[model samples]
Target chain A: MNRHTDTPAGTELLDLPMPEPRTCPFGPAPVYDRLRAEAPVTRVACPTGLTAWLVSRYADVRDVLGDAERFSSRPGQVVHLMAHADPERPIGEGEFTRMDGPEYQRFRRHMGPEISSPRRLAKLRPLVRAVVDERIGALAAAGPPADLYQDFAIPVTTASIGGLVGVPYADRDLFHTAASGVFSDVTDQVQLAAAVRPLQGYLFELVRRRRVEPEDDALSRMVARAPSAEPPFSDVELVAMSAVMLVAGFDSTATALAHGVLALLNDPGQWARLRDDPSLVPGTVEEMVRLFGGGAGIVREATVDTEIGGRPVAKGDYVILAIQSANHDPEAFPDPGRLDVARDTEGHLGFGHGTHQCFGQQTARLELTVALEALVRRVPSLRLAAPLADVPFKTGTSVVGPERVPVTWDEILPAEGEGP
Target chain B: MRVRADTALCVSTGSCALTAPEVFDLGEDDGVVVVLVESPPDEQRETVGRAVRACPAGVLSLAP
Candidate 1:
């Protein structure tokens, strides 16, 4: 099926076969590396059974992500079932993920103030530090053989998002269960709708309470900020957004952090350089963003027949921007696979490139930087508690992480001033 | 030369502050942006440059 008709602009629309997904010893999937090295941009069959272009070139991905109008995010980004899913009842537009133009901007603006500043994020530093410290404490208490992913990273990230989204500390378990259930494909429409009902119901109550008694929290602020309209969330939006915040804030950062630490650990020299200079943490974080390769791709469905990467994509086709592959594109970064903590990763599309670039990035950065720095400093002698091969690497469908990163240290007792 | 933020346009994402904390600070409540000094330490020029590049909303500039 390599034959293709010429576009009106006279560009050739060559049919490119989708490369098989990449898996290698060095971590990143092979499809990405192969695309970056060989094809960059090619056509692929999406999970939704639609054939569309997958842009892997760094410049191309950034260009698409930046031009939000051309590559609309509203086009059923999530799996159709997931997007149409109703936790209570299969419903209409759920939240910002699938929204565009006015409505997207409206809700985005309402929530912007909370996540826009270092100051806003700084407020959560103490809480994040506490979570980090607690995780470290648990890891230490459990002894050398501990899965860092479970014992440390996941919990810290979940707790941090829980705190930020105004999930009462006591009800975090409920939030976690519901969040996980919502993402997992346990059922068609019924299970998700049922799971979401309780979670959204709680958020509704929380929003109502916040409206009457505004707290110094994001939920309260967003409640006050969202324009008074016909459906001022109707308790539904509040709950939905709250759950969205938890999933968005928690999983993305958590996965990034886990993979980042794993990358550093695998590379001794990079780890040493970062540990030696705490000042390098910022650069290190960007490199991690480049390497973590968070979302595989941002999926967008076509509104009208259009040409992408010189290929004719008919209306209703889904376009997937291979973000992870693009980040590794050699044209974008010199020696892309080399874990240079000092690499200028300014344009890396890890947290995404443009307007829809993660709203919680600042928060993610704070969590990762602080957590990584503390781990490096405190666990100076930290090493993998189990063989890399034996470790259950987090993989397959959706988010990727180490199911458990078991680590060990030969009891390098804490510094005199450092408290346990 | 150093980068500074025009607080009026600043969205307060702290991309600059995170990139070069030595050269940028944010107000506690209102989220107003602040440059560290009329001129930052020379050693921080590259960091400041990165800060200028990191500002997503394009509110930061370099002063020669």
Candidate 2:
């Protein structure tokens, strides 16, 4: 939805939507299947007029993502939801995801130790479980037929992220609102502005508060490190980092939880299997990550001319790695459409493959595991309130899934402290 | 199976330690790879292989 101002004259390019539209709720857009088979490395246009070689074969996708030097992790390649920042300026330090080489490693040295540290995640598990229980309790109290997407999935993810990043309890609404606006549509200018402007002001204020008073949370840990570190982290950079934690991390897990639950409810045997055997939760979470990778494409720009799946890709050509399609590739995943919760889903590009793979993937797996285990345990007879076709899905965006899931249950289980 | 990890290459994604804690761990100071057991039991081999494959940095390995 950017202005598409850079379109070149002469030849035409296909302006395919990044997430595209899904013919089946459970699979990626059908076009990807054909693209993988017919033209695994084919050119497609982004909203910004950059023509990219959309790579669909699992092996090619893996190679492109895994080779950091050959394929750069620059920022412009993203099929972005938010309005673009100035493209001319140098990528400041601490903007780690888009950075490559030593600069990327520098941020990782500071952040990797904090966010996914063994000690931090141990404390995080119970907090996430508590959030899951609280949301489920509220959902049960509200209705036998409840809207899971709005009422359950969104709140749980928003609250957990708020707690993870040390955002105050009162400001979680602002976080949730901004996430909703950005995920809904890129074309809607009013919603885009509302999502962007307020969050910037609020994050700066939050960072200032963390400066004076550090807490046992990810942001505070970074802030505590900032003052002592070499070439210290600027407050603006900290704000940008926090925004990514809240907003980028927000919808990924929510959609996984929402879509996983929705899909499970539709498959009664699978739902019952999970409820009966809690030990399967880990593998089920992996399956959820596989099917609902939460992204359609993860883009990269080639550093030099290279061949992918036998097709020649030119230097500076953007390669759109189809994460969702790669997960469903028959070469990688046998019986790709079938949801086998116990399937060996390792090496799937669900969290992405390498270099810039998801920093919070382990936490996301833990979150999905705890949430799914709790839901299946608390509401054994849970089922969908509406038909699968009737459900509204998020389209034309990176993090894609069902927007709303109306669910119903026969009986709700009480919280541990509450009487049966 | 003998598990090997290169801490210098470890980015601390924690996939190895989380998947096969019996074989690997993260350093308390810097959160890099730390191998707990060089040769794991036959019972531990499967998870250890998973740990090796799951390491984002491709630093974890095992002797055949």
Candidate 3:
């Protein structure tokens, strides 16, 4: 699925596996280069009986995502996931991610302080660091020849997510399994509901608890916000929003960590460079996530007649913003193939754009920053146990990354304060 | 150039703060964009431009 070089019989419209389905693991598919160069906006036949105008160019994709008025996100992410009988997700009461206009803004504003405010990020920093370091320590204790994806990366991210959504330490196991189930590939209504029911019940109870006694977390913050809500928010709405944070934040952040680690370790020079200069970790986080992380492409349905790059897109048309392709767009990123740690990686469409941008991006950044910085600092001898090509990547799921980042380290490196 | 930020529109992606730390920051409590240097110096003009461009929400704008 790497190159997509099967010579598009000229009529074979694009299907799933949009970006990588790449010639190189380090960058996006060459098909993107050809498509962007040839036809930036082309028709894509979706399994959901929909026709999506796949926008590949950087500016055009940005335009579509930025302009919420013309391009509506109401059809929601399910449009992207609406394959293999994946049922349409009912946009819950407080699930603003799928909403439009004022309804969406109300939730975004209410939850903004708890989840993404600068204050929240600062508050979250220490938690993220402690969690990351603890996870790495566990990884080291478990010994090398480990799967970083499962053992270290996922747990750190899971805990970080727990911190954000206010899942207690003892409850993380139940929360983690349920979180994975909700984001799981199971599309059958019976199976999906089986997964959703328990998690929903747990969240509903949690929200109810938060109402009774507010905690210093996102859910509690929302509970406090409920009474003053314009139309008055309900407990159900709070639970739904918490699920949104869980479902949206969980798999993507974990994958980013795994993918970023793979991207760095794949290039030894870059790995060594990062290990040498800890200061490079922050910029390196941006670069790696730009190349290897970010969410799956965003789906926006046009509300009114619009033209993308002069292409006539009638109202009701769907547009798949190929974010990975846009990130690799040479026009926006010079030598986009090369991973330059110091490169100005700002404005990479990794976290997406506009009013409906990723809600957990700052949290993701904090996790990535602490995890990568600590991983390099703690495991200086870290090396991939398997080559990137041999390492199976997750193209099957909506969240793309190495399925299992197997790595081996020679010794456990101690921190400055710890006993040598 | 003078900068203006509309907190109402901010999703708090924090790109502005990350891009031009001197010119912009995220508010401690609300996480909306806070303009540090409303009019940045000559040395920071390019970074400021980038910070504005980097904002996905179109929350930041520069006036010459």
For all predictions in the order shown, the interface RMSD in Å is 3.8, 1.8, 2.7
Q: Please give the lDDT score for candidate 3.
A: 0.75
| lDDT (Cα, tens digit) per residue for candidate 3, span A188-211 | 556656666777898988988888
- Candidate 1 vs candidate 3: the lDDT winner is 3
What TM-score number comes out for model 3?
Answer: 0.90
The local distance difference test score of each candidate is: 0.67, 0.75, 0.75
Query: Model 1, stretches more than 4 Å misplaced?
Result: A1-22, A25-27, A80-94, A185-187, A227-234, A303-306, A412-420, B1-52, B55-64
Tens digit of per-residue lDDT, candidate 2, span B1-64: 7877766666668888788877787765455678988989999888899889997667878887
For every candidate, what share of the true interface contacts is present?
A: 0.19, 0.45, 0.47
User: What are the clashing pairs of model 3?
Assistant: A2-A22, A22-A29, A117-B31, A118-B31
CA shift of A215, model 2, Å: 2.2
Question: Model 2: clashing residue pairs?
Answer: none
lDDT per residue (tens digit) for residues A1-420 in model 2: 232232334334555545533456877777777888887776677664455667788899888888888888874335433334222237654567778766665566566656676767788888888998999889777877888887888778778878898886578767667766655535365666677668879988878887788778888878777765556778877777777778776678888898888888878888888888989889988888888683567777778878888877666666788878889899999988778777888788888866577877877877888888888788888899998878998765556889889899888898667788
- The candidates' DockQ values read 0.25, 0.55, 0.48
> Which portion of correct inter-chain contacts appears in model 3?
0.47
**TM-score of model 1 vs. true structure:** 0.82
**Candidate 3 docking band:** acceptable
Error of 3 at A386 (Å): 1.7
Candidate 3 chain A weakest lDDT stretch, 10 residues: A1-10
